[model samples]
Structure formats: structure tokens, C-alpha cells
Target: MDEFEKIQKLIRLKKYETPGEQFVDEFVTAFRERQRAEMLKQPALSLLWESFRAWYDQLFSPRWTLAAAVVVIGFICGFAFMPRGGQTHLARRGKAPDHPAMTLSLGKDQTGKTLPAFSIETIRVMGEIEIEPDPGLLSKHFTGGYDQIVIVPHDEADTAIAVPYDFIHLDGKPDIR
Candidate 1:
């Protein structure tokens, strides 16, 4: 009538039967044999490789093998039959070919005679470009027309000479000669 009583009644009615000892022994032996067989079987990778080899062998039968062989033979024959000779036309200039031709000779120390990448004057101009002129100096030297001016540093003394109306400003203007 109660839950516990019902459970007890069910437990009593239920057959708690187990297999015979011989049957249990035979089942465990069969299970162990199955496990041993599984352990002895090839790994998945080896099985997959063997299957791939079989598939490849089936795919490339006698016909495919003959076609591949023919392709290789054709390539070999093509290379063997290729023409070998001087393809360039030569001009017979009566003069014998000279070793180390005079035309190929270069002037000695050509770089020494060449002009520098930037002259001293060019460097001076660049130096002037970087200098921010004194606002008082700018007010005195620069007028409304010229926004920029170049200050020349005279080597005679350590004095920097502000060239009036000669400096280059950010505003577009022709070079003051």
C-alpha cells in the first residue's frame, strides 16, 4: 500500500536470476578472444594505405600503364630529335676577333672626374632651407611679396648674413639669383 511496501513487493516478485557459472565462463572467454583478435588486427592507417594501394592498382591497369609509358617514350624521342647548332648569324668583319676588345675598355678613375651628388652651393642652399629665420629679422627683411628668403653663412667670419628678399619661403616663388 505504501511506496516502500510496493518496492519491497516488486523486489520479492522479481527473479534475481544470473547465468550459470559455465555460461559466464564461456561468455568471458569469447569476449577476451574477441578483444585479442581486435588487438592483433592492423592499425587504421595501415589498413587505409593497403586499400589505397589496391585502389591505385585497379585504377592504373594495363591500358593506363601503356599510355604513361608511351608519354615518357614520346618525350624522350622529342628531346633526342631536337636540332643542335649555332642559331646566331655572324658578321664577317675582316678584322680578327680581339680578346678584351678596345671598345670594352673603361676610362681610369672615371668617378674622380665626375661631379658630386650635391655641390657646396647646393648644400648651402639646403642649409638655408632648414633655418627658421628670426621673426624680427623676417619682419625687417621679408616684405609681403616674398614669403621666403635664403640666409648665406659667409666663411670669412662666423656671421650669418640674411640675404634680403633672397630666401625661399613655403609660398611658390622663383629662385632669387
Candidate 2:
């Protein structure tokens, strides 16, 4: 006989036996008992998990809490140090010059003309007029030969006058005040 056939014949003739029935029953019973114990502990484990989640939320629940605190503090500081209406703390500290008093008046002329009078300790003009367009022709309709005219107040004289009454060209230079 060949070596392979001999080995196969020996293996066939050998006895193959399973574990005893009592051992299998005991093992299964122990496994079932252990599984039951583990199942009984699941409720406690779930309770612990819920408690951990609650603790975490309590620790970090303030969304943007630091930012909110900073804004509130800033508001409090601003209100505490801000100037009141019509008055300034800087003025009280003498860091700024005192404002001068001013007076305004309106009177009528002998010819029944309304006149506006103003008096101020200090007067400043933020902007000045250069070439003023004609006020008389502002309401008139556009014509082919119509030219733009401007009225400017004379600094030396009290009355206002136009440089060119009819047709005048400005050299794009402002008149001296």
C-alpha cells in the first residue's frame, strides 16, 4: 500500500469522540447565567451614561458666555464714563476752551423791509461760495442765448452784486473775500 493510503486508513480506524453531555449542559447553563447578570446591570449603566451627559451640559451650556460677559461690561463702562446731554466731561476737565456766548436778532427797516441781524463772539464759515449762478433766471425756461449768472455778496460792501449782469465768463478762479 502507498504511504498516503496507509495514513488515511489509520485516521479512519482511529476513534473520534465528542465531549460528554453533562459538560456541555453545564457550560451552557453557566453562559446563560452570566448573560442574565450582564443584562440586569444595563439599567445602571444607562443611568450612569445619562448622568455623565447631564454633567457635561451643565459645565459647558453657556454658549458664547464669555462674549456676552464682555459686551455687558463694555456697555456698563461706556454708560458710566460717557458725557451727559449738552455737556462734556472733557470740558469740565479744562482740556478744551470755553465756548463763547452768542446772540441773534431780527429787525425791520424803515422801508418795511425785514432784516436779519446776528451777533456772535466767534463766527466761522465752513464753506464759501465762488461763482454763484444767477438767482433771477433760475425760474425762467431755458433759451438758446441765455447765460448763467451768479450773485455773490461783497465783503467790503453790505449789498450783494453780480460780476457780469448779462454775459460773463468766469476764469474758474474765486473772487477774493
Candidate 3:
């Protein structure tokens, strides 16, 4: 006979014997009992520990961990390097919006208040001035703003320029300005 015919004959004769129902039931019961015993042998973790483990699992889940990490890192970097108020203009290299909305030119036609003529020496002095407070706009001026002229020497040059030091805080203190 062929191999296929021989295999069919063996199947018809029930040559492959399985365990009896009683033995199967006993084996399953023993298995369950052993499993229960093994589980009972290990002590339960504390609520705090269990919660931390759960949180850690969720935080590191493969489907979301990378995206979540990127978002968290982005937020940290943005806030850490973000410029404070009133300094954003300086950070962007733009004119400060708080002071001097319009540039006054020499020889006014309507007001007739002859704008001071700009000279080369005066312009050089103006360039040395690090900060200038608007005396007209008290609200826009720095905190503790007052009329006090103090001359400070430039670090890079031998020239001494006058500026209100309180108005030129490097740390940008809003309360002091």
C-alpha cells in the first residue's frame, strides 16, 4: 500500500490514542492548582509602586513614546529660550515698540519747533548711548524712571557716553524699570 493509504488505515483503526477524560481532568486541575500556588507565593506590590509602574508603562508605550518625548522636549526648549516681554523687539533686531513711535525730522512746517539739526559728533554720541528713556510717556518708561544723567565709558572705545543706568538694565527687570 502507498504511504497515504497506510496513514488513512491507521486513522480508521484509531491508532493515535489520547488520554482518558478522567486523566485529562486531573491534569488540568493540577495545572490550575500549581498556577494558583505560584501566584500566591509572590507578595503584592504596594499601591504607590503599582501606580508608578503603570505610569511608567504608559509613558514608554511603543506607539506613543517617541511622539510624546518630542512634544515634551519641544515645550522645554521653547520656554527655556523664549525672550521675556519688551525684550522680544531687541531679540528680533527691531525698533522697540514702547518708545519713539515717530522719527522727528529737522525743519517742521506745521509745529514750527525747529528739530535739532543732526551733526556728525552728536550722531557719534547718540551711537554710544545704549538706552534712552521717553520722558513724555511715563507708562512706557522703565520702572523708577527719573531724570538723572550718568556718563559711562564704552568697553570697546575710549569714549564716555551719558545714559540713565536704571533704564538700561541687562536683565530686563520689569519691577525696577
lDDT scores in order: 0.45, 0.45, 0.46
RMSD of each: 27.2, 22.5, 13.3
Model 1, 19-91: lDDT tens per residue?
Answer: 7669988999999999888766979887789889999899999899899999999989976774332111122
TM per candidate: 0.23, 0.21, 0.33
What total of clashing residue pairs does each candidate reach?
Answer: 5, 4, 2
lDDT of 2 by residue, 81-138 (tens): 7533223323334333244322223344569785543322221212221122322332
**What's the true lDDT of residue 177 in model 2?**
26
Where does model 3 exceed 4 Å of error? Answer: 1-15, 46-61, 70-177
Better of 1 and 2 by TM-score: 1
User: Predicted candidate 1: what Cα RMSD to the true structure?
Assistant: 27.2
Off by over 4 Å in 1: 1-4, 12-15, 44-177
Candidate 3: pairs in clash = 142-177, 143-177
The CA lDDT at 113 in model 2 is 83
What CA RMSD would candidate 3 show? 13.3
